[model samples]
Target: MSFADLGLSDELLQAVEAAGYTEPTPIQAQAIPPVLMMKDLIGIAQTGTGKTASFVLPMIDILAHGRRRALMPRSLILEPTRELAAQVAENFEKYGKNHDLKMALLIGGVQMGDQIKALSEGVDVLIATPGRLMDLFERGKILLTGCELLVIDEADRMLDMGFIPDIESICAKLPTNRQTMLFSATMPPPIKKLSDKFLSNPKYIEVARPATTNINIVQYKVPVTARKKREMLRHLLRTDNVSTAIVFCNRKTTVRELAKSLKQHGFGAGEIHGDMDQSSRIGELDRFKAGEINILCASDVAARGLDVKGVSHVFNFDTPWHPDDYVHRVGRTGRGGARGRAFTFVTPEDAEAVQNVEKLTGGEIPLFEFSGEQPAEAAEAVEEKPKAQRPRRARKDEGAERAEAAPRQEAKEARSEEPRKERRPRRSQPEPVDDGWNGPVPEFLHVSALV
Candidate 1:
C-alpha cells in the first residue's frame, strides 16, 4: 500500500515521494495507521525491513501541529547508539522536508555546547542516546514532562547494551499519557517487560519472526582458518564482484585490523566500532554510504539501526557469538527489495557456534565449498609438511652421545673439588628426556620426584 492509504498527511506523503519511496514496507503499512491514531505500538521486524520509516513518517505528521517550548521537545526518540540516533535524525530531515520541524540530537562524543544551544532554541523532535539524554536531563537542560510522543528504536539492542535502566528512568520522567512506540528486531523478555511497564494497550505489529534472517539473502558458509580470514575476504571481494558490502567482525580489534588489512590490499574500505570517536565513525559511514568506500569492516555496533541502502553483500569474518546478531549482520544487505549475498567464515572450532546459530534460525545453513575444491582424505593430508619429512629428532637422539653425556657431565660437575662448587648455579638444569614409550606418570610423582 501507498503512504496515502496509511492515513498520513498530504505533506508527509509528498515528503515520502520526494524521498523516492513509492510503496510502504509491510512494517510501515501495519504500523503507521495505528501510530497516527495515537495508539501505543510494539513493532517487531527484522533489520532492513524499513522499520525506521514505519514510525518516522507518522510521527512527522503528528508532530507537525505541535509547537515546542525551550528545553522541552514535543517528541523524543531514544536510540541505543549514537549512529542510530544520527540516522533517525537524517530520516527526519528527509521525510520532514515539507514540514517545519526543529530537531536536535543529543549523543556523547560531541560538543555539549552545540546541543545545549539547539535545546535552548526549542526542538519539536529530540533524538538522543539514553546516556546523553539522561545527562542533559540531570543537568536541568532538557525537560521530559512536555513530551507528547516517545519512540524507543531498537529496544532489544538497548537491552543488549545495558540501557534498559536508563530507558526506565527516562520513561518515569516523561508524561504517562504520551503515545509510546517501541520497535526491535527481536523481543526478549526484558524488552517485553519494559513495553508492558510503559505502553498502554499497545498494538502489536510483527512483520517477521524474532531473530530470523531474511530469506531473500543468499547465505553461505565459507570454511577457512581464523588466521586466513582476511586473505579469504580479500579473495571474495576481488572475485565476487561486490558493489557495496559490510564485513562484520566479533571484536573491535578485528574490525580495525581487517579494515587496515583491506586498505593495505588496495580495497576501498573503512572501519566502525564502539571504540571509535563519534565523528570518525559517522564520517566513515557517510563515506561508505556515498560510495566512497566499497567495503565497511564493522562490529555489531553497525549492525543495528543504521540504514545504508544498496548494500549488495555482507561478509562475516567472525561468526557472531549471539545468533540474533547473525540475523542483523546479514540483514545489512538484501534491503529495500533488493536481492543480496552473505558469506560467513567458519573454522572447525566455530562449528558449534554455527550450529547454535542454525538452531536459532530454525534451518541448516548450506555449506559452500570453494568451487572445484574437495575435502582432504585425512587430517594429515591437509597439513603442509609431509609426514615422512617431519623432524624425527626425538627418536634419532635416543641413546645418542648427548643423552649419555648429559648425566655424566652432571655427575662430574657435582663431584668437582673446586670450592666455588659450593655455590649453586642460578640457571636451571636441563630436564631429563622422556623415552616416549613409558606410560604417563602421576601428577604428584612428576612434580615432587622431579623437584
Candidate 2:
C-alpha cells in the first residue's frame, strides 16, 4: 500500500512522494498503521528494510498538533549510535517538512550550547543517542515529563553497545501513558525483558526472521591471510563491476590504514570510524553518497545507519567479533530491493568467527577464489623450480671441465718422452739399451696435472 493509505498526513505523503517512494516497505506497511493508532509496537525486521520511516512518518502525523513547552519535548527517540540518531533527525526533516514540527538532535561530538538552546526553546520531537540524552537530562537542560511519544530504534544495537541500563533509565523517566515503538533487527533476551517492562500490550509485528541476511545479496567468504587481505581486496575491487562499495574494518586504525593504502594505490576511497568527529564522518558519508568516492573504508560503528542507495558491494576486511554484526555489515548493500554482493575476508584464525556467522545465517557462505595466483602454492612451487634448474647447469659445467683436462694430459706425455730421449743422446753407449724401453713405455705410462 502507499503512504497515503497508511493514514499519513497529506503533507507527509507529499514529502514521501517527493522522495520517490510510492509503496510502503513491509515494515512500513505493517507497523505504520499501528503506530498511527498510537499503539505500542514491536517492529522486527532486518536492517535496510525502511524501519526508520515506519516510525518517523506516523509520528509526524501524530505530533503535528501537539503543544510543546519550554525545556520539554512532546516526543523522544532513543538511538544507539550517533549516526542513527542523526539519520532519524534527517528523516524528520525530509518527511515532516510540509508539516510544522520542531525536532532537535542530541548526539555526542557536537557543541552542547546549541543543544541546550534548542532544548530551552522546547522541541516537538527530540531525537538523541542514549548518552547525550542522559547528559542533557542530568544538566536539567531538557525534560521528558511531557513526552507523549517514545521511539526506541535499534534496541538490539543498544544492548550490544552496553546502553541497555541507560535505555531503562530513560524509559523510566518518560510518562508511562506515552505511546512507545520498539524496533530491532533481532530479539535478544535483554531487549525482550526491557520491552516487557516498558511497553503496554504492544502490537507484535515482525517482517523478517532475526539475524537473517537479505536474500538479494550474493555473499561469499574468501580464505585469505592477514597480509594478503589488502591485495585480495584490491584485486576484487579492480576485477568486480563495483559502482560503489563499503569496506568494513573492525578497528579504527585499520580503517585509516586501509583507506590511506587504497588512496595510495589510486582508488577513490575514504575513511570513517568511531574516533572521527561528527563533521568529518558526515562529510565523508556525503561525499560517498554524491558519488565523489566509490569506496568507503569504515569501522562498523561509524558505518551504522548509513543509507546510501545502490551500493554495488560490501567488503568485510576483517571478520567481526560478533555474529550479529555480520548481518548488519552486509545489510549496507542490497537495500531497497536492489541486488548486491558481499565479500568477507577470512583467515585461519577467523575460522570460528566465520562459522558463527554462517550459523546465524543458517548455512555456509560460498567461497570466492581470487583470479590471481594462489599465495601458498605459488610460493612453494616457485622456490622448487629454481633449484631444479641449477642442478642441470652444474652437471654441464663438470663435463666441460673433464673435456679440457683430457687435452692437458697429452702435452705432459710429450714432455716426459723428450727428457728420456735427451738423456739417451747425452749418455752415448750406456743409455742405448734403456732408450728403446723408454720409447715403448711412453704410450702406456703418462701422468698429467690439470688445473
Question: Against the true structure, candidate 2 has what lDDT?
Answer: 0.88
Q: In terms of TM-score, how similar is model 2 to the real structure?
A: 0.83
Worst 10 residues of 1 by lDDT: 373-382
**Candidate 2 collision pairs:** none
Candidate 2 per-residue lDDT over residues 117-144, each given as its tens digit: 8888889999999999999899888888
Best TM-score among the predictions, by candidate number:
1
Instruction: Write the residue-wise lDDT of candidate 1 on 1-451 in tens digits.
Output: 6778888888888888888989988999999999989999999999988999999988898988867799999999999888889888999999899999999999999889999999999999999999999998899999888999999999988988999999999999999799999999999999999999999999999999898888789999877776676767877787787999999999999898888888888999999999989889989988998999989999999888557889999999999998888998899899888899999888877889999999988898886655543333212223445447666565555568788889999989887955664766455534546778587755554343333
Worst 10 residues of 2 by lDDT: 424-433
Error of 2 at 82 (Å): 1.1
- Candidate 1: C-alpha RMSD to true structure equals 12.1
**Regions of model 2 farther than 4 Å from truth:** 369-451
Collision count of model 2: 0
